[model samples]
Target chain A: MQTEEEFRDFILNGHLYYIPHVTIDCAIFGYHAQQLKLLLIKHRNIDNWSLPGGYIKRAEKLLDAANRNIKDRTGIDNLFLQQFKTFGDPDRIQFDKFDKKKWLEDTGLPSWEGNWLINQTISVGFYAITDFSKTRLQTDFITEACAWFDINNLPPLEYDHDEMVQEAMHTMRLHLYHYPIGLNMLPEKFTLSEIHALYETLLGKKLDVSNFPKKLLALRLLKKLDEKRSIGAHRSPHLYSFDKEMYALALKEGLVLS
Target chain B: MQTEEEFRDFILNGHLYYIPHVTIDCAIFGYHAQQLKLLLIKHRNIDNWSLPGGYIKRAEKLLDAANRNIKDRTGIDNLFLQQFKTFGDPDRIQFDKFDKKKWLEDTGLPSWEGNWLINQTISVGFYAITDFSKTRLQTDFITEACAWFDINNLPPLEYDHDEMVQEAMHTMRLHLYHYPIGLNMLPEKFTLSEIHALYETLLGKKLDVSNFPKKLLALRLLKKLDEKRSIGAHRSPHLYSFDKEMYALALKEGLVLS
Candidate 1:
């Protein structure tokens, strides 16, 4: 709880050196157009792709680091962020082959005496759901370009990032059983078919529409709107929004079958 | 993939030592008779009370560390172990008074340079549900006495260990909604009244005996046995053991009545 001037002085001096060793990486996944997508960035160092990550500064909290990561990469803050797990296996990184030592020597940067440039990385994994259409993407110093890729056709990610992405997806699937995950993926005022399609994609199968609506209606977690969809066949389907309170109660007490 | 000798040498005298910084702390809990109980240890360091925990070895996984912790303290290896969460706040340790400098000076140990001693202490929270009858507790180098205390009355614990216990209890309560937790807490071949009493304690309320039996029977997760309890003045009650597959299914799909 030091003052601004004191904090500035501490940062300038070596007493409060920011531990650049710790970094926060996020596995941002969203459903769009009936497909699961992951946010990724191509790194400049090894020309390999990876999830958007940033180093944790000394003053910031772990969740703050996650927020900064999401902001730095996609310019989207205050989304549904949850810490899934931490990756701390010694073989999590292969920096020896990356030639980080040579790069440091070439740059004339003083050698890091601590576990800064070693295999002692403790990465905190955060799973986020964002409005992909509203994201303002930015490519920082380490990355070349950032984009969203369909999870099915993802390229080989650098380090153990692919494993992290898989873990995040697994957590998302577990949460999706109760929560309305499609609401985050789809735009506002979506049709019944649109929501159904997203659910089908996540479940990875075709479900009978007759039984599906009956089950969803029984739960009463959705609100049928007056407005109908402008596209599709002559008889357009009505739009629906999630009944927040009912869904929350359903999450707590769990959905009941008719 | 390395040979046995090579792997041994790598771990023992490795280039950069992979110190097992991670630890598992178990707040073994049980509700007996009418009072809740918590397992704790009197630490040798500064004569403080601490949770039973130890440094995780390089060879074992996180779950192995928890099992090892429980085995080291209680001399009982076969117990229920569940990984609830990991606590990793950077300032989680008291650094100002008993800082890293004091710790290094006190130990008079070797470099231990690779060990992230003071900077970060990420602990995995695990809890065990034991009958309290089977435990043969032991003391280690840093532990003086291992004993169980009434949950309502607990001694001050070291290093946010109290919060960790509360977290374990929170997880147990969440699990109770789906699965039966007091099964291990009670003795084998427990009476129906005893089972109901344990559930009442866990639920923190006295349930109607009539409705309780009906609802519990409907779940079909328990198997009624012919053995009768031969104790107390009341009529001998029937005994029951949980059906493993049925219990697991009920746990996955929560048996909610509301």
Candidate 2:
């Protein structure tokens, strides 16, 4: 197996024997303030907001490229990055009749010879749910600003990124129905109501509070804490944390929380 | 959007372009007599067999390519062709230093000049569940024979196909937990016991028939027919067919029956 450093070197070497037209972009999703959020960057030239993305180096896997793009721009490497789907539409990168030759000319980047542009781009999208508090945002030379946007009110995204985000949301919707996803988006300990609130946010609707507790308890994926919230006007609710082992075991046994 | 013919022409054009180097391969899983079945095609040169697969035509979607491959080989299209996962290991095709360039050269097929060889091979894997009786299998010039082997006793497959099958199984396992999948693999209308038997064949173990009916019935994804099983040593059992509306709705809701 190639070491991480060796892999990075191999990818950045800029060899010509292989096609170098491919790029990997990540739709890093996070649940924050009771809304779905996506990390976006303002490019210097495009003048449009887009997902934090970059090219896949030669030595790295497509997933590795996504992780590298996330960490290189955000200083967070351990985020859960799972590949969702591939965007392989032939016209996916048709930025206004800009063919391969024109693309190279416009970018002023090194023109990779060989059917570099003819090699169709199969973009492997990844969804990363990260602890927003721990992220240290960093902007690359090509980018001007970086921030998170509420998914409900997204800015105009460049290229096929909007479509990518839509696909990710569809996948997330499916995930929320089967697995508790926003647990990482919450604090270390959270109230039952708060947990329910997160689910509501993800599902984009209300859930039956009466039967939810029984269902969750039956699943036994969470551990109730002794502490209770004291500040809110509503009644104090007990807090809970996910039991990783039990959750893993339950999923293995074909038990889904939702 | 380009016309289908135009798209086909673009893909067939001699100009080597940077289109995504993606291949669509199907696991083509079937269940028979409490045993998992995998459809395999014998390769041209070696003793090894492979899952029916094809390269993603430039104009063709990955899922379409997989379906087209299955149809070309088995004369079965318009079935459940689900896009399960996309594999993009940079060296996934590398076995015994047999890289893409070397393989292309060995094929002795017309080669095009471009970085297309170096382009990432993102394979979109789909699993098609079809009744073995309904299939009319055919072999291409590149293939020597086609057969369905018990998945439990699979022959060594070429490339990363074995891993691909495992991934498909994992996806199927998830589907089995919440949805009725073997409907396509079984006769038009099957007895409840036959359906349960099919599940046993898929899960590779016996299940509590009593509780199994409760879950299956509760899901309401199947419809009981007025007719009964035609042939059996014992008393004929009530037959059932998949409820199309309920199945579509359940699929949309991501509800697994198991």
Give the count of colliding residue pairs in each prediction: 0, 17
lDDT of 2 at B210: 86
Give the TM-score of chain A, superposed on the true chain A, for all candidates in the order listed: 0.80, 0.81
Q: How far off is residue B20 in model 1, in Å?
A: 8.5
Superposition-based RMSD of candidate 1 using all C-alpha atoms, in angstroms: 8.0
lDDT of 2 by residue, A1-258 (tens): 113443234334644433354567788876766766789988655656888876666567777778877877766686767666777776787745535544444544334445343345667788877655567787754466888888788998877889899877767666655565655777888878777878787777788997676777777878998888776688787888888887676544445555
lDDT (Cα atoms) of all candidates against the true structure: 0.65, 0.69
Cα lDDT of model 2 by residue, B1-258, tens digit: 113343234344523432345677889876655667889998555557888876666676656667777877666677787767777787777645445445444544334445344454667788867666657677654566889888879998887888999888877766677556766667888888888888887766788988887777778877888998757588888888888888787766557354
What TM-score would you report for chain A in candidate 2?
0.81
Deviation (Å) of B222 in candidate 1: 9.1
Model 1: residues with Cα > 4 Å off, grouped in runs: A1-23, A45-48, A94-115, A178-183, A188-193, A203-239, A243-258, B1-24, B27-38, B42-50, B54-60, B74-80, B94-120, B127-131, B149-159, B166-258
What is candidate 2's CAPRI-style docking category based on DockQ?
A: acceptable
Q: Which stretches of candidate 2 lie over 4 Å from their true place?
A: A1-21, A45-48, A95-119, A177-183, A226-236, A247-254, B1-20, B32-34, B72-75, B97-120, B177-183, B203-220, B226-236, B249-253, B256-258
lDDT of 2: 0.69
Q: Reference contacts recovered by each candidate, as fractions?
A: 0.04, 0.40
For residues B100-157, write the lDDT of model 1, one tens digit per residue.
Answer: 5454445342234443444555566777666565567887544558998877788888
